[model samples]
Target: MTAQSAHLDDELNLKALSFHAQPRPGKIGTLVTKPAATQQDLALAYTPGVAEPVRRIHTDPDLAYAYTNKGNLVAVITDGTAVLGLGNVGPLAGKPVMEGKAVLFKRFADIDCFDIEVQAETPEAFIETVVRIAPTFGGINLEDIAAPHCFEIEQALIDELDIPVFHDDQHGTAIILAAGLLNALELQGKTLEEAQIVILGAGAAGIASARLLLALGAHRDHLLCVDRQGVIHLGRPDLNPYKFGVAVETNKRTLTEAMQGADVFIGLSGPDLVTPEMIASMAPRPIVFALSNPVPEIRPAAALAVRSDLVMATGRSDYPNQVNNVLGFPFIFRGALDVRASRINQAMRIAAVEALRDLAREPVPQAVLDAYGLNALSFGPDYIIPKPFDPRLRERVAGAVAQTAIASGVARLPLSD
Candidate 1:
């Protein structure tokens, strides 16, 4: 790195440290929602009046939603195995990230969250802990656990808990990706069923994206997943069950080979793993979502320089068409909580995808434009996904998800409007 860029990085690190430190030791704390100032109020809040509601809740368990904060609360739980790019930092080190997620839950959707960091030796131990405490909140948001284990933990929680259990690292990434990919394909005059798509990662986000894409009608044979072992095809002997799910009988054995004549490329791997040659080798009007953060697999400038017909996106906010998790998780939880949904099922996820995809096609609102300091943005090659600050996101995505949940028979309560 240049001296100037290195200096900037140091400055940013200091600023971020101060931002989290000076305001308080951490980013989040609880606020009491009920009055407890006066003697009478204390009696009502704790002993006498609280006992009446406790009795009602004991008689009818659903009454807890009416008497407490359970309807609006979520637990953001993590084991720190895959905390951002800093993998396996441990539970305590991962606390800041979980708290940041809580901040987003409140800021974006007005949902309350308690960030819980678990120190469990085994996946089964962690699962048992969450299952034991599942009654306190309306929903659960699993974060930052590493793959294979993450897949197992999430499925177990979903099966055991009645409330929605979501791993944002997996489904949140998939939901936004699907929305952006659908729009990009439409602009390129391609369809998901026929697009030759290559995803260069086999971890949680990569595997989940593959599954959601398949559910959305991408032909299984048309998709390829590449890990460190190169392309995960049927011939690979070391494939795990998750990798095996997306594995196909293809002669392509490497990322370069997989990219040949491909219609789309999605990189969830580390920086600079993709080359200009790979970008150039793709079909005309290629869609490239190099979604690795801080640095993409191929830098946007380099990729665009290679192919002007490219429709590119990354996980960076400075770039147009950012495929961000912030655009999905908050609103998704909002919708699920509103209807007391049993789970965040496939139909609800597809509804969120369609909501986001369709929203991008509309005219960009002035508020959103102002938030990004852009004079205008239109739905096209450069702008394939809705901006994170788009106010309509809560109503559009959340409403669709809630309605779909009710229609799909997963909701415990009907939406009043």
Candidate 2:
């Protein structure tokens, strides 16, 4: 309905820089819940009065919910090995991203977060550190750690901790991708089972998304995942366990080979890796989600230049159908925290997927339309996923998660059912 101007990038960048700097050098900070404006308030907030709740929590661990902020709090933890598009920037450098995660948590879902950047040299140490501080929050959201190790670290934490430990990079991206893909395919008259899908990155998001799509009835034999060395096929010497598990015996040996007549392309890989020629080679009415951040595998303009029949989505907000993690993580954690779920299981994720898919088909609210300055938005090629600022995301996604957690028997608190 509207077109973005050419100077939008520079304007956005300058505003972002100024906002971050003017907002006291960082994005988030702690807020005191209990008042301490007076001497009486101080005593009740800290000294003898605080001792009573501490004693109760010590006696009954569950009392931490009533005594402390643990019930609504999540820890955004990272090892800085995979800081967004900037790979392996180290733990200290990853603080801002973690803080941004915290900001999203608070802003979107009314959930609180403490961003923790770990300096551990090993996944074992990182896991240990998180475990040591597990009691500090209701949930743990693992962020921006590199692949393979990210998988291992998340699995370890989930197995060891009673609280929910989720790797947002892996599962968050996967959930959002699945939701959008489901809707996009529905609009395009393609089923996940019938689609020939190619994912151009075998890292956390790619492998996880492929696995999820399979769980949702995608034809395993029709899928191809390519890394820098090319398609992750059987007998590939460099395959890690994650890739190895998903790499079936397929004839497609390279990105080019995999793109031939494919029904869908999902890119979690680097910039400009996909060309207009590659998009043109896809099957009729193809679905493309070029989700690489800052820069995508192929720009929408370039891809559309070659094929007008296809549906395209990028990770940028400037584009239509942004497959943003913001649409997944905050509300997912919201639902999990509400129900006090032990873990974010597959059932919960499926609920999120279904909720998101169903929401996109509904009428867009005026507030949401106003946020984007749009005249109209609908469940078409341009609007396949719900916007981040849509108020319904909190109610729909979070409620679905909490209900699923209850139905799946993972919820600890009686928040539902």
Candidate 3:
């Protein structure tokens, strides 16, 4: 790092510490939505009047939606095994991220959230903890859990509970990625079925992205998933079930080999793992989403220096095409909560993908342009995904998800307006 960049990093670190410390040391808190100043309000909020709703709900369990916060509340649960780029920080340290997720939900979707950190010794224990408390909220946003275990926990929760359970690291990344990739392919005059896609990092995000891409019509044979051990081919004996799910029959055994003549490169691995040689080896007009955070696999400047025909994206706000999960999760949960969806099904995910993909093709709003300090942006190489600050995302993505849930018969309530 340069002296200037080092100084900037120091400044950001100090500012972040101060920001988190000054505001009473946390990012979220509960707020009373009802009047509570009088004795009658107390009686209605807690004792006598609350008993009526309790009785009604005891007779018919669905009345909890009408009588309590269950209709619009989400539980942001985490075990801290995979907190951001920092791994295994534990539940106490993971609280801040969960709270940050709650802030985004409220900021973007007007939804209420309770951040829950579980101190469980095993994955089964964590699953039980969340299942026991599942009735308190409309949906669950599983955050910061490690792979393989995360996949198991989320699946168990979805099967056991009658609410949406989403692991944001997995599906949120996949949704935004698919949306951007679709637009990028269109601009490059290619198609998902024909593109040679290589996904580096066979963890949660990489595997999920591969699955969603296949669902969106990408040929399974055209995709390759690589990890620390190289390509996850069919002959690998140590592959987990999740990694094995996306394993293809390929002769390639390394990331360098996998990138040869590839049309798309998705990096969920650590920073600087991709070289300029790898970028140069890809097919013409290749689309690359170097999505590792704080730093990408290959910096945009370095990647662009090699191939100007590349369509690049990162998980950074400073970049032109940022694949942020905030663009998907808030609105997705909003729609699921609004319609009382039984689960966040594949149809709902595809609906979100299409909504985000279609939104980018539309005219960029002035407010969004101002937010980014850009005079204009259009659907092209540099702007393949919708900006997070775009106000249309809430209505557009949420409405599509809710409608798809209803059509797919997983929604218990009809959409209002």
Clash count, one per candidate = 0, 0, 0
Model 2 weakest 10-residue run by lDDT? 1-10
The CA lDDT of each predicted structure is: 0.95, 0.92, 0.95
Q: Encode model 3's per-residue lDDT on 193-279: one tens digit a residue.
A: 999999999888988999999999999999999999999999999999999999999999999999999999999989999999999
TM-score of each: 0.99, 0.96, 0.99
When sorted by lDDT, best at the front, the candidate numbers are: 3, 1, 2
Residue runs of model 3 more than 4 Å from their true location after superposition: none
Q: Is candidate 2 or candidate 3 better by TM-score?
A: 3
Q: Which residue pairs in model 3 clash with each other?
A: none
Which scores better on lDDT, 2 or 3? 3
